[model samples]
Target: MLSICKIYFMLFLYLSINLFIMALYFILLNMEVFIEYNLLSFNSLSMVMIVFIDWMTLFFMSFVLFIAALVTKYSEDYMGLDKSLNRFILLVVLFVLSMMFLIMSPNLISILLGWDGLGLVSYILVIYYQNIKSYNAGMLTALSNRVGDAALLIAIALMMNFESWNFIFYLDFFKNDDMMKIIMFFVILAAMTKSAQIPFSSWLPAAMAAPTPVSSLVHSSTLVTAGVYLLIRFSSAFSPMFMDFLLFISLFTMFMAGLGANFEFDLKKIIALSTLSQLGLMISILSLGNSDLAFFHLLTHALFKALLFMCAGMIIHSLNNCQDIRFMGGLSLYMPITCTLFNICNLSLCGLPFLSGFYSKDLVVEIMSMGYLNLFVYLIFYLSVGLTVCYSFRVVYYTFTGDSNILVLSTLNENSKIMLSSMIGLVFLVVFMGSILSWVMFPFPYFICLSFVMKMMTCFFILMGIFLGYECAKFSLEYSIKAVLFYNFSMFSASMWNMPFLSTFGVNYYPLFLGKIYMKNFDQGWLEYYGGKNLYNSLKMSSSSFQLFSRNHIKIYLLFIILWLMFMVSFLII
Candidate 1:
């Protein structure tokens, strides 16, 4: 206990130091223009918002402190009893500090460096569990993130050649039409990968292979949101093509993930899919060129998503590390506080009115009413919201409200105060997030209230989802690869990941998966047959022939045809 306290104290103390430095940097930026300050740095010179919104950096960093506190306290219970507990705490501290630096950076070059540092540390934490499975997931996650890094670096190279790299520089000067379009392409591709849109969505769901605390920070708070945050930050120079690209990709990711979460059995995997769905919504909202819509959702999503993940973690922890929601039930009987926090998170994620998610969710829907947003776009976003409710409620009902399946009644689950306290505080924020967002004035208004009729009508979807999700739970507790892969829930679908067993389980399904198997074999056969003997023998026979042209009647004919065409052109010219 003393060791845990010491670790928490050190982390909190370090965060407090960072917070203090940010405040001082902010103050210095606001000071009347001095010769000394102007010579010190371009970032300090260019920042105009420092006088007023500089504290926003401090606001974002407060969450860092909160997460660090949770990591330190939670590690004490999960690891402090272990021999290497202190090392774990040190690593967590370093990871959060890197995130703070990354997010608060003012310049593009600084931002890229900070971004790489952030990815490296989070990659380390994901594999810190040290299992082979964790290592594999970590490597795949790192590789996917590196795709974004490459795109970002390429954009930087282009900017340097054209001599336009900083946000302030772009705002003040340099707008070449062709160069701007090229830069936008690289920027959007990088953002899409980091945001986990569609094909790149494979990685985030696999990231559930990480520890629970790591998921809270990676999915709920920072890494996944970085791309959308960048989109919101650098949206000024976006052309129409860029916005259209962002809109379509964001909607596509939403539907793909929303459908997949419905079939997942693992508790963490469900939240992971839900995270993808939410990120999709976030990017879609930002793509509309409304900074308020993007920023409002950004703040609200953090509270509710974090609350949901922490609650899911508590439920899994209660079962002696069982993760599949199939075996979990009757948790309301065992842990009332756990159920209450879980319900609050679900309400917010599902966009229950007066909840934080409702404010941002409604704002995005309302913005869609403008001629700019088509019905097809609105339909996808709204349907994903309904599906979001379906899966989120599926988690709560399957894990808590239903009959007991593996109910071991030990001393009741009061979720290790370390975890519960952070969750409880977050739950409070989730309940009031809309209230806070309604007051946000960073840019345009995203605080539009929905009419009573629409609010009343939207409730029907949530109610229907809950009823259907409950009904679906009773018949089948089994998991299948087809269900998992189709919905992109690769996290908990290990059963058939390698061995498809597509035919063995009384199924004639998915000719595509079988085609891939044959394709692999087919490619190898061509390589061995042609390159090894057939093609090699053909080459040798051709070489051994005394007269190369005499043996090939077809080549001699082609030479005459080419010479005739050349002769025709020469005659015409003469």
Candidate 2:
């Protein structure tokens, strides 16, 4: 029965894949299809739904569906014979549907609908394990995203001032308007939350409590990239102040994530942090007035990052669910295919020349260099790049090259064709997507005239990063000089400047305290007194008065009527 269900689902995904391809054919022919309808209207405002399909929509939809199909197929074997297999498949499919809604919409209302759907579905997926850790992670994920959802709502409300819920129409008209500036503010705030930029970033690593396939889908393409896509759509209307603010935050996020990844010991958390760093890079490029470059990087990164997570999932499964890299070593000896895929993904992450990440990442660096940035910004960008390379190599050394670190050898082998099949599909994209996107998206090559010194710095940083990574891994047996000398600082780096603690305890303290106050002062106190107790007392008093009137009988009623007639006669005489 399960096998039949899986076959049917796979067939459905394949059908969707073919549909997207047909859409891509139209896109290649430069045919854009836009359709809109008014669902209802009230007092000169209409509830509208807009679907805009251009080259970007078709291209992105193709990749998204392709990956979803692979992941769904992969999950069949990866999940084993769980009791909730059907539920898991259902949630994954719903997640994809929500993402498709997000991809197709151009109106603010439609976007919000899709955005909130992503949040709600992701929360459900993250807590699917029903364990304490997953519950906590799900709450964190949902709450963090709720901030963005609220911001989206505010942005939508702000768009009401323009009398149109469709933001696509206002991009050109409101280019320099002050009201649009305010709207962009909320948009940026919303983007920051979704992208996990600084302060809101701690939830991302914590969210690794989810299943590995969910991690692959969430981190790589669907959830996090929503912010980048939103920004790409609104790029033309961003003011210079917005750009500056975004650049600062993005650089900080990139630097922070890189530092965190270097010190992280958990395998999944390390990869999660790396995803955060790439997200930062995408936003930073978008900040530098190059949304095209950011979008390109987003696409390329999705291909490789998805493959990376799939590889990680296989390793963890093979190792009997152990996720510590310290316990994993010499994997190349047992699973050569997995190791090769891992290395390819990691190298692609480092933006190695000619790979998928290289085309976009290299262009971004060069374009940033050409811009007139301050010394601090320039150094942070280059340093972050170097950190990226360092950590990529470090991960490579720890997982694939070292001697066997486990006490007893388990049967670690990649015999599952379903899992390998998904990874193999992505492998081709991880290798060629850079060139493919470049040829199709850009009509002209990015021509930059830079000095030899500036161009050489990128290469120099790569070498330095490699050297530093080699030395760090080479001295694993020896005591770390940095750890010994600066214990406090080392701990800070490991804890990501206490950001996790701050985001968890620090954020919770105030909210929980406020909730208690509300419970005591309002919910338990005034509300009870005024709404419950007072109403009960008032009703009781009225009942008692009625009883007294009834007990008095007909004589009192006649006396009252006579008194009323006498008063009326007295008024007429006056």
Candidate 3:
């Protein structure tokens, strides 16, 4: 029954892809659809649900469902023997549904439903393993997302200043209003959190505690991209100051992630950080006033990044859960298919020539070059590209080349047909998705005219990155002086600049200390004395006085009654 259900879901997903493609063509012909309904209203504020679907929605949704289907089918074998297989499948399905809801809705209220749904479902999936690491990772993921959720809620509250809750209707309405600008600022904050930019970045790596399929689905296509997509949808509302701020934060995030990936050893984490770097790239590009380019990169990165994680999953499964790249080498000799796919995905990530990543990435770089950027920003962008290639090659060299690092008797190979078939589905897409998507999305190429040095910077960086990656991965540890001198910096980069520590303990220290003070001073001190202790003491004294008065005799009671009667008579006379 489980097998039948999985197959049915896959078949249905594929059918939907075909239908969506046909719909996309129709949408391209400018036959768009807008659906809106009023569910409820409270005086001026109305609960209006709006869905605006053009070619973009159909196209991105098809890709998302396609990936989800493949991941679901892959999980059939990857998680086949697990006792909670049904639960896992259900969670993935719910995740896909939530993403679909997010894609279709343009209403802030409706988007919140999908946004919160993704956060809640993702947290559940992250901690599905029930281990301490997963638990901590889940907490981090949930709390980080709550920041975005709060931001979104505040933005929605601010949107009430306008008559409509549908932000699609009022894209230009908030431009001149200071209050509206503040709301849009919160909206950008929400996007930054969802996309794992800057401070929110610690959650993306921590979320690797999830199964690989979830990582592929969440980190690659749906979860992290949620922020970029949101920003893209609302790009017109962003001010120049806001864009500049985003550009700064995003560049730092890109540089940081790229640098961190180079220092990383864990196979999954290296890729997770790569995803973060690409996210930074996407958001930064979007901030540069071209949502189309950012969207292009978003789709292409989804293809290769998902494949990369799936390949990592296969390798980890083969090695009995070994994720450290140092213990993996010469895998191309035994696991030829897995290694080949890994190389392809890694190269695509590096934006090599004609692969999906190259088309969007190269264009982004050239366009960025033409922009009015400062020296520092330009260096960070180009250097991040170089670092991307550096880490990609480093991963390839460590895991696929050199001597065998696996057990001598181990029979590791790409024998899992289920996993391979799922990957094979995306492999074709990752290779040709760029050209096809380019032709579909753009009628002509972006006219980028630059100097010889600027035009060739990408190639130069690629070559340099290859050299740097090889030397660094090959001899960084072996050379005594280099290792000793750079040990602290290496550790800092490896630890993601202590982001995990900062997110967990650094952010918690003050809050926890304040909580302790509240417990001592308020709960146990003033409140205890004034409310609990003082109330008890006053009650005891009153009871003792009443007992003494009662013991004195009937005269006391008679005197009290006379005084009460006199007071009542005087009040009546007045």
Question: Which is the winner by lDDT between candidate 2 and candidate 3?
Answer: 3
Q: Which portions of model 1 miss their true places by more than 4 Å?
A: 1-56, 171-176, 407-412, 442-457, 475-574
Candidate 1: what lDDT? 0.70
The best-first sequence of candidates by TM-score reads: 2, 3, 1
Clashes of each: 2, 0, 0
TM-score of 1: 0.75
Task: State the C-alpha lDDT per candidate.
Answer: 0.70, 0.86, 0.88
> RMSD to native for every prediction?
12.7, 3.7, 4.7
Q: Find the 10 residues in a row with the least total lDDT in model 1.
A: 31-40
**Candidate 2: where are CA atoms >4 Å away?**
1-27, 40-46, 475-477, 480-482, 540-574
| lDDT comparing candidate 3 with the true structure | 0.88
Model 3: per-residue Cα lDDT over 1-574, one tens digit each: 4584376456757766785676557657977779878889999776666888877788778888888888988898888778988889889888888888998888888889999999999999999999999999999999999999999999999888886677877788667779878988998989999999988788988999999889989977898998999999989988899999999999999999999998888999999999999999998989999999999999899999999999999999888888989888899988898888888988888889999989999999999999998999899999999999999999988988988787787767788899999998889999999988888788777888999999999999999999999988867647734666677787789788888788666897898899999999989999999999999999999999989887987888899899999999999999
Q: How do the residues 107-177 of candidate 2 rate in per-residue lDDT, one tens digit apiece?
A: 88888888988899999999988999999999999999899999888888888889887788778889899
Ranking by lDDT: 3, 2, 1
lDDT of 1 at 516: 74
TM-scores, all candidates, are 0.75, 0.91, 0.90
